[model samples]
Target: MLGVSFLPLKELFLKNFILVRDAHIEFSPGFNVLTGETGAGKSMLISALLFLGGADVDWEVFSGQRDEAVVEALFVRKGEVLRVKRTINPEKRRTRAEINGSYATKSALRERIMPLFEIHGQHENELLLDPSTHLSFFDRATGLSELQREVESLFERKVELESELRKRRKDMERLRQIRMLKEYQLEELRRAELREGEVVELEEAIERLSHVEALKEGINRVLDLLYRDDHSAYNKAYVACRILEDLGRFDRTLRPIIESLRGYGAAIEDSWRELVAYEERLEYDPEELENMRARLSFLRELEKKYG
Candidate 1:
């Protein structure tokens, strides 16, 4: 009892526990012990306390046809009453706990409730033999428990910061990869010498080159019809003008008709000259066409790859 005037755990209550349907125990000041027959529910009382201390137990502890088992403890310190309750539902296969009648977790029970009292079994001396618990005992003796708790908190914070740093490093690596890829793409586009509307211009050029021979043949036919052949429009217009001019000399009413025929002949001559120049300008270079085709193919590949 650590020199306390009253027991820290004042009372323990159990319900629907194995071999003990309902039992209540009250403790007096100083050390206490329970001694009874082999099946007189003494160990069951200890089990109830262990359950209140957040120890895990199986459904068999619920006894008979009970739906749930409950273990509760009351403590008195500095004239304050603190109550802890633990409940296990066999059907649910889970434990529910409370502190001072409010909801609590098993971790809360272990950290806050279990520290209020100590339970010693037949092998209790093993705790003294183990070296791991020596620091806890020393801290308690020297009143350094608060300092240890602070150090533990700081250590936990350090661990959290380290984990966050690792995550940030991974994110930075991912962003670096993305930035490198974008830079590579920019370099490729720079090398490509892309221009606005370039694809449309290339496609039009390819179409023209594909039909260059057909276009030249068509222009030749047009020239023959307009002026190249002996029965062409220019020759006919010239002959018609002469006939009209001779008629106009005989009759003044034919003068307007002769002038109109001369104008027609002039228009035909201009059209024939323009057609001949256009046909001569049409050059079909296979090597130039192949180069354009290669450039266009490369552009299409770039488009597909990037997309």
Candidate 2:
């Protein structure tokens, strides 16, 4: 027969566990047997006790209906109470063990509290194999020696959010570098001082000025042909008009021809005057042309360098 100290559990408190969200229960002095139907949380309570005794609990065993699950127990041995608490945190993928309201390790919890109970099941050895067995159940008839062992495997998962946060911090630095590079490029562009339509206007000015000598010669030739030459078109037309006037005095039908010839002479003189005015407007400044060429070359260099 087992003595009173063989069953050392005094009280247990569970919060946010699988089915029992919150529960408080007290055990008798000796040989406490939990009685309930098969699926009535009897096995879950045992698992909770094992978890309190510093045995590793697979994170998947919790229902995940809550963020955290807590299992605490009070054990009595020789008129002394051993209070142990275990907190499971799913988010951080970590487990914490406490003893008597102070933080403790799994080893300390096992060395102190595991000797209080005997656990035996077909798959139960899996949980006990880590440190040692502490809690086991017996039927009402204690003669049956059948044991079922359940081995629970557990692995601490890497918290992906923390990893992602670290990666995001690195990415932030990269983004900052890219932004600074763009700022430097913008500063270069500003220093260059580009104008919107200046390139096209300067190109056109260069095109007109490049052909200045040829245009001047052409305009002088036209002025000579119209007014300065000995047989200029304007003088020839005037002479023709005088002859027509004399001929029209003899023939009345020739009066209209005389009037038309005089009008033609007037139009030629107007064109001659306009040609002289146009010739005076032609200019070729070497310095201005050189400056324009230099400006165009500078713009081309800038395009090759930066664009």
Candidate 3:
């Protein structure tokens, strides 16, 4: 039979574990022995202790209809109460652990918690003979286990700090490279000597050059119909004003119509003069248009590159 002993076990609770449905066991202080025939669940208690100590188990055999098993143990260590719980869930394919109501990893349970129990199976002597376990026994005997635990904690902290320092250094190096690349790109854009709104201005200039003939033609048509044609609007208004002036001699109310026609004739002549001046200013330089197109293309390329 396997034997287990250690610090005082205050309580052990098991549920859906092997043949045991639900068991709540309390132990007293001092020596205790578990005696039972084969298949009487004596070894099951030993298995529960091992599993609670972070030892892996085949959950299929322990699980109930719900495919879950749980083991919780309360122990008094150095006059302090310690509680540990282990749960098996085959459906999730994972084992969960808790210590004093807080979640803990199985490794943490083995390193910090499992030392509370001393298991003595039939082959326990084999493990006792292993050289790796001797240091732990020596530390306990010399009362230096606490000191060793402090040293281990410091070492773990040092390793974590080193890892964080290395990551920061890597990130800084990447940022340095990125800054250098952006500086080079900025210099390239500066060399181009680009101006704000220059692309829009160039596009407008190009459009004016492209349709110079159409614009000139439309303006000339307006000017001719308004002033240059024999029967132009200006000439018609002048003739109408002269006829109304003669009619005013016959009726005093016709004088108002005559005055309005004269104002209309003068407005038409003013519009024709402004249009002629605008038509004279139209530019048709292909070289200037091509240069504007090229400048616009360059600016667009820069936008595409920088963006």
Q: What is the C-alpha lDDT of each candidate?
A: 0.78, 0.74, 0.82
How many clashing residue pairs appear in each of the predictions shown? 0, 14, 0
Q: Choose 1 or 2, whichever is better by lDDT.
A: 1
Q: Poorest 10 consecutive residues of model 1 by lDDT?
A: 1-10
Question: Which candidate would rank higher by lDDT, 2 or 3?
Answer: 3
Rank all candidate structures by their TM-score, best first, as comma-separated numbers. 3, 1, 2
lDDT for model 3: 0.82
The TM-score measured for candidate 2 stands at 0.38
Which one is best on lDDT? 3
Instruction: Estimate the TM-score of every prediction.
Output: 0.58, 0.38, 0.70
Q: Write the per-residue lDDT of candidate 2 for residues 1-307, one digit (tens) a residue.
A: 1122243778889998777889999878756677778799888887787777678868676645457888898877677667888988877768898888889998876755665555666556443464433233242235332332112111112355667878999999999999998999889778868898777888998887889888888888887887788898877878888887888888989888888878887887888788777767768888998898888888788789777
lDDT tens string, model 3, 201-241?
88888888899999999999999899999999999999888
At residue 98, give the lDDT of candidate 3. 93
Worst 10 residues of 3 by lDDT: 1-10
Ranking by lDDT: 3, 1, 2
